[model samples]
Target: MVLIVLGFIIFIAINVVVKNNPVAAKFAGAGRILALVFILLGISTACVKQIDAGEIGVKSLFGSIQNDIMGSGLHFINPLLDVKKLDVKTQNYTMSGVNDEGNKAGDDAIKVLTSDGLEVTIDLTVLYRVVGADAPRLLRETGEDYRDKIVRPITRTKIRDNAVYYQAVDLFGSKRDEFQQRIYKSIEDDF
Candidate 1:
């Protein structure tokens, strides 16, 4: 509506200028082009995605997240907002104690006993999906460097700190699964 009104006004101005001064009317065309760009950008930002079956969408307006979650099918929204698609599908990650070399990492799989008697090693795979509303926040806080900023330090800290509480056998032995869970939780919370 706003664009339509502005467009109509610009059209009238262009006609009046064309009738009076063709050169001035030509200059006004440049302003119309700029206005057209703004309108297109606004429309693009207000994009709507038809949610897939069993999926939900998160939306943000001018970077402020909206709580109105989107479910399947057509939805209406302001063009000044952004839409993010999120899969609500069930997913799982299969983990086994293994290193980069493909060998079964020992009980201390992720942690090795240091010369000073500290044991530590960390090997794990993660499965993750972004929360729709928080995607913009996540992007702003970490940008494209999220993995490094959020993942590595939390992981290293958890493994090292947890190792201090357990011996090499506990780190690498039957208790390995427990350790893995602890590390996963730590990183998940911190990240």
Candidate 2:
């Protein structure tokens, strides 16, 4: 938009200058060419969008979201529309003491009280991805920061809720898988 305005300004200035001075006529032609270049460049750039591999593009016009989910590669879209890229690859959200590849390590491990009234710190690593087909719905419902807005809060809440159903010793030792499965089910239901 700025480019188009700048081009229009240059064209107006050139027209004014050429009428006053014949010597400036040659420079006016060059100025007109430069303005055309700016306008063309802006239009061409605005007409296309690129979605990276393992990502989905969500389109929006003004503030209203469109339902179409664009796959990886170059896509021709409305110049005025906005495209938001969302990573669809599996991401690891970790609550751990050490940082590792593919893991979003953080100090905020989940703490929950067991049936026995004992408190336990649960170090969890959740691997999840947004379904490409559901990308539009995800954007409409949760916006762009769905990981922070939906995933993290829901995962933490479900884990803490399920933890109270089991004994602390069972959660720490023998029945770990069962507890994990319950947490998984709870989180999956939300999606």
Candidate 3:
């Protein structure tokens, strides 16, 4: 947008100077050429989008979403549209009380009420990624910060919902795997 405005200003100056002086006429032509170059550069740069590896591009034109998901590489798109990049790489989020490297800490740990009316604190790690094909839909529904808005909320909710089905002791002992699997299934279904 800046480039387009700069080019227009230069074009106007070129026209104003062309009729005033013969000596400045040559410079005016050069100014016109420079303006054209700037405009072309702006348009060309905007039209070509580069999506990095393990990422997808979600294209939107005038706030309306386009269905196509751009894969990793350079793609030609409408110059006026906006392309938002979403990482498709598998991400690991740890929910824990102790702040470990690459893990989220503090009160983010899951707390749930068990069937026996006991409260339990569970630390969990979620390994997941955004589906490349669903990037467009995800962007349309959740915007750019889908991980915080969707992934965290859904995972936390599902864990709490499934936790109440088992005894607190079972959740920490023999039925651990079953509890984990149930939570996983519920979260997976939402995605």
What TM-score would each prediction reach against the true structure?
Answer: 0.49, 0.87, 0.84
Winning candidate number (TM-score): 2
Instruction: Note the Cα lDDT for every prediction shown.
Output: 0.60, 0.86, 0.85
In candidate 3, which residue ranges exceed 4 Å CA deviation?
16-26, 99-105
- Which has the higher lDDT value, candidate number 2 or candidate number 3? 2
lDDT of 1 by residue, 1-191 (tens): 46645655766676677789866865777766766765665465445457787667667676765667787788867655567666645433322354333222433234445334964555555555556556556655665455556654555566676666566677668877887787678767765
Could you tell me how far off, in angstroms, the CA of residue 109 lies in candidate 3 after the best superposition? 1.1
* Model 2 TM-score on a 0 to 1 scale: 0.87
What local lDDT does model 1 show for residue 53?
79
Q: Clash pairs of candidate 1?
A: 46-79, 107-171, 107-172, 107-173, 108-172, 110-121, 110-122, 111-120, 111-121, 112-120
Residue 147 error, candidate 1, Å: 4.5
How many clashes (backbone atoms < 3 Å, residues ≥3 apart in a chain or on different chains) does model 2 have?
0
Q: What TM-score does model 1 achieve against the real structure?
A: 0.49
**Residues 20-129, model 2: lDDT tens digits:** 98899989879999989988887888888999999999899987888888999999888999998999999877765454532464456778899999999888888899
Which residue pairs show collisions in model 3?
A: none
Off by over 4 Å in 2: 1-6, 12-23, 97-106
Question: Candidate 2, 189: how far from true, in Å?
Answer: 0.8
Residue 170, candidate 1: alpha-carbon lDDT: 74
